[model samples]
Target: MLAQPDARAAAALLALTAAFAAVVALLPWPAGRITLGAAVGAVAGASLLVDLGYPGPYRLPAFWLPFEWLALLGLLFRAVRGLSDRRVGPVGGLLGLAAVLLPLRFSLRTPQGGAAWSVVGVLLSLLPLLGVAGAALYLRVLDARRERAVARARREQRLEVARGLHDFVAHEITGIVLEAQAGQLPDQEPGETAALLRRLEEAGLRALDSMDEMVGALREPGGEGGRDGRSDPPDREERADGATTRRLGLADLPELVTRFGATGAGGTAGVPRATAELAPETAGRLSAEAEATAYAVVLEALTNIRRHAPQATEVTVRVAPGTDGTVELTVTDDGGPSRRPLLRRRPGAGGTGLAGLTARAAAHGGSLTAGPGTPAGWRVSCSLPGR
Candidate 1:
């Protein structure tokens, strides 16, 4: 009066199990997926060997079910380890497919209690295999996001340090060099005493102070997220930040204007007079990014004028903010002599300054263009989105 087993149910279960296995096999990063696959193979081989040798009364061996569950646990471990690669899924699936056979065989053996029960067993066996694949995929996605975030943070830090070097430290050093050059030497004015020594001492102190701050900024943790984009610790140097009253902006243009005369020129041929025009609204309210970029564009342009256009004079700088929420900065020099060719002995000579500025602009979702100007000059200009 026992129930009759159904072959149709067993066949359907096997088909579903095979489909699941195939889907899992094709996953990427298949390295450790095979571990579960191998364990499944081992279970099938051992089960078949036991069935053949002791075919008498092994219908429901207590040890067989336990081994099967243990194998599934090993499979879960494989999935976790192989999370970074999708390729392991398919191989793992194949192992699970083999495992389904162990349960299928048990169902096919019993007289009245065979196929129907086997189908249920096969479905349960396939559940853990699918679970592992899903877990691996989740881990892979999490790792990828972490990597991207780290890379972005690193790029920002690099821009911060580079900007500090060019905008803060370099600008201060250049001014010191220029002032020292313009000063009368001790030998040139022998009778001059305390005043000249005092000026020299003050200039030296400023240079040293500026350099010490640059080094500290570079070393400080949570790097350079200040108004001026410097790297000091929070609140320690508020006045030192560009947000201070003396921060340079369009308002400082007149003070920045100077006449750069060619070093060896006779009279006026090589001397260039520099001028700046700032739109009335361009000052006081610009963001740190805009002010930094605009200041750098003008500084680099002037530096290049001295370095390459020693024979040409006349430079013009303009700062204008547009109605479309963008600030435009331009620096042009009336055609100076061509920049000197690269000194092959040095690794990077004439290219790094412009490249650094280009990177800085792009990081802020802005653009800078530098090339020969329309009529006869070299132009460096940038447009930055205003916050």
Candidate 2:
């Protein structure tokens, strides 16, 4: 009752497997043995497929069935593993399917009893195959998840580096630019000019320090995400040389304002002297993320003022608790003309700083806005959620 075998379709694989089996059985030479061993799965799959389709009473030499069945099990395992690779996946899948379905071929020979036997045989074969395939898929899933996690960690590191450059380095560079401008004032005394140069050097040094901190953080394995899988803040990192870098936070606003005010002290007309009105309650209530964002908002505002409104006589930075559980930050400058004509706003090139701060604030459930002040000045305001 065996089904008619498709001799034409199965001929190639049959020949290949027979040739390999013959060499292993007769010659026993190392190369022939190695080749047969290396191709055992393919040989087994081919033998099974041919046997299933072979139109004869006596199957493919009973001696080969035991070896072929064992090898077919191995082939099934390999097929599951190969599914992840695009190159050999199709071939492996086809061969594995043939090998796995070989048991069902029995219904052709045994009439009524064969149907029940074939189903039982297929279910038994499937139990082991499912176990093997499940393990392989589980491992692959873990690997994919790990790759995604590493990619996410690296993206966060890059963002931290960008923020450090923008918040700290840009602030220092802007101060340097302002100091250089103050030195160029026509009636400035030599002593005052020398003092300005010193401040410029200090700002340059601070910018360099910030760059060094960022570079050290990048060089560390796992970056701000510690090797132990703990994610520390970008500001809390140790250098390769054992030096710790301190982050400038809300507490540092007074010093930041003083330095900014000093940058314009030597200028003749409407010299800008920045002031800070930081409320203790707001500072104490804000979370670390909100505090950092608030600090950046102020830093960026001050930097922009130096670039665009250097002649403003009054500049004020205010931080206070807003209605609800939110902290509000405002940096306002008395609208005045730019003394450094060279630093005049290039049309459409501004707002990049504010845009960056806006994104940073929004990431922590906060918002930012910039527009003309009540009477005559530019105003930048940000509201951030608290703890």
Candidate 3:
């Protein structure tokens, strides 16, 4: 531009510089669409000047083509990243399309009425854009998949915490309700009311324990308790026999299954045949969260079975080490009549028990699946790392 100090050359240089800067600075912003509109207007004006054969040394775009290339690359990237955000996406699309066209202005020049050269030039100029478009489209698809995965993970985590609360609170609340009903004995015997009050106190205290553990699980890591709320479970000394404070694990599953089966534990006589196949070596290796999750999985499955399939007579609980160093827990039951199907308790503030169990399993970098068994019944199976 300095070699030819004409007014037209100077003016064209100024316009091109401003156009390049505007494209670079404004295309990624909320008001980016305005920038694209201005660029289109500039291109239209430049085309008119060329048609009128405007005499200007700046007619050659050599000084600005590099700037356009850099801006297009940056704009294409922004378009890929911003596609998930509605505010910035449309502007990015328009800018990327415009960027591809800028090169065509120089490359697609054919002599007047030169039909064969014009067709070849147009094809040559447009071919490169297909590659750029393909890359931008692939990146957009990947971004969408990543967003969906993150959303799914968050939803599952919310349900897991809900399950922790539901499982513990439900167990304690069941006890409390039963105790309250027993306390309503019509004829008061000599110390019956006092014994009932003691039972109520125990039930209420268990509920408090459940609340603590669940809240601890919900809290952010390193700010409160360990993962799954109670990473350091109570030792044998801390767990008194027959005490509600007893720490649960694979070892306690037999008693839990028996309790669920016994008629006195709020089920029909001979509710089901409960069996266990827990690995003998799995007494202590599991992290607190994993162990707790395993227990919750079985508890919820049994609860569902008792509620949904009362006539199921055979249940198998298995805990074993997987070949891939994960702990696998499975609870399966033979088909049963749906006794009093509508009588099943409605889900509380937390979701249905299985949803919670699924969350818990996933939290441990494991998974849980409950589906129909080979012959007839249903199976709830899970695999998770110890940590």
Judge candidate 1 at residue 324 and give its lDDT: 77
Query: Using Cα atoms with residue i matched to residue i, what is each candidate's TM-score against the true structure?
Result: 0.59, 0.73, 0.53
> How badly does each model clash, as a count of residue pairs?
18, 0, 0
The digit string of per-residue lDDT tens for model 1 on 6-104 reads 344433333333433333334333347554445444444444443333222224432344454445445444544453355355545544555555565
lDDT of 3 at 273: 78
Off by over 4 Å in 1: 1-71, 77-87, 98-115, 162-276, 311-313, 322-326, 335-345, 355-367, 373-376, 385-387
lDDT of 3 by residue, 1-387 (tens): 244436567456545753754555454444545553344334434433332342333335445555654555455555555544553455555555555444443423323334454345446545555565567777878888998998998787776556655676676565455445445536667786776677568658867877775555445445223333554434321211212244566777887776555421223323477877889767676776578778888888776665555567788899998766788899998765534431336566334678757876887899999998768778999897864
User: How should the candidates be ordered by TM-score, best one leading?
Assistant: 2, 1, 3
Give the per-residue lDDT digits (tens) of candidate 2, residues 22-58: 4433433235445433454455555655645555333
* Candidate 3 TM-score to native: 0.53
Residue 26 in model 1: lDDT: 40
User: Cα lDDT for residue 263, model 1?
Assistant: 24
User: What lDDT score is found at residue 334 in candidate 2?
Assistant: 81
Better of 1 and 2 by TM-score: 2
